[model samples]
Target: MYIITVEYVIDPGHMLTFMDAVLENAETSLHKEQGCVQFDVSQSHDNPTQFFLYEQFVDEVAFQQHVESEHYLTFSQKVQPAVVSKSVRHWYSC
Candidate 1:
């Protein structure tokens, strides 16, 4: 399985708008993509500007395809101005 956690440091003022875009992307990925197993978004309890995304895919190829998808591209473009910084970590299950 391929799992990843993406962290987004967002500008506090744009939280709502950013969430809207990310949520749409998450829902679309989960419902429309056969390789997408899980796509979840969460806000930090202490810091509302920090967002976390937990995503699971069938494989690296599936993930690459997700990155190339139209919805994902739209989300990325829409949220760019709201984002302060972003980071991603890949996971391996034994």
Candidate 2:
């Protein structure tokens, strides 16, 4: 499996809207995408503006397909203005 971890620093005032968009993205991935193994969204206890997304796919191609999906594109557009910073990491299961 291939895993992607994304850290997002959202604008404090836009937290609710950002959460909505990201939640939709996660839901769509898990429910609609055949290649998606798992999708998890988490909020930092110490930082209200911080969010983490853990996504697991069958392989790298699955991840690429996810990026090309319409739901993800919409989510990206919706949350772009609300994000202050973002970081991503990739890993392969042993």
Candidate 3:
């Protein structure tokens, strides 16, 4: 399995609104993408403006496909302006 984690630091004033958008995006991604095995989002308790997204795919190909998907593109475009900073990491399950 391919596991991906994304961390985001959002603008403080827009945190709640950004999370709402992310939640909707995650729902759409999990429902529309067959390659998506899991898609979860979490907020930091210590820093509410920080968010983490965990996603799992069947394999590299599945993940590549997801990156090329419309839903992913849409989500990116929608959240781009709201994000202050973001990082992504990829891992293969042992």
Residue pairs in steric clash, candidate 3?
none
TM-score against truth, every candidate: 0.96, 0.98, 0.92
Instruction: List per-prediction Cα lDDT, in the order shown.
Output: 0.93, 0.96, 0.88
After superposition, which runs of candidate 1 have C-alpha atoms over 4 Å from their true positions?
none
Q: Rank the candidates by TM-score, best first.
A: 2, 1, 3
- The candidate 2 region of ten consecutive residues with least summed lDDT is 12-21
Candidate 1 lDDT, tens digit per residue, 1-94? 8998999999988988998999999999999899999999999999989999999999988999999999999999999999999999998656
* For every candidate, C-alpha RMSD to the true structure in Å: 0.7, 0.5, 1.1
Order of candidates by lDDT, top first?
A: 2, 1, 3
- Among all windows of ten consecutive residues in candidate 1, which has the lowest summed lDDT? 85-94
Across residues 1-81, which tens digit of lDDT does each residue of candidate 2 receive?
A: 999999999999899999999999999999999999999999999998999999999999999999999999999999999
State, as a TM-score between 0 and 1, how close model 1 is to the true structure: 0.96
Off by over 4 Å in 2: none
Q: Give the TM-score of candidate 2.
A: 0.98
- Candidate 2 or 1, higher TM-score: 2
Local error of candidate 2 at residue 56 (angstroms) = 0.3
Residue 76 of model 3 has an lDDT of: 83
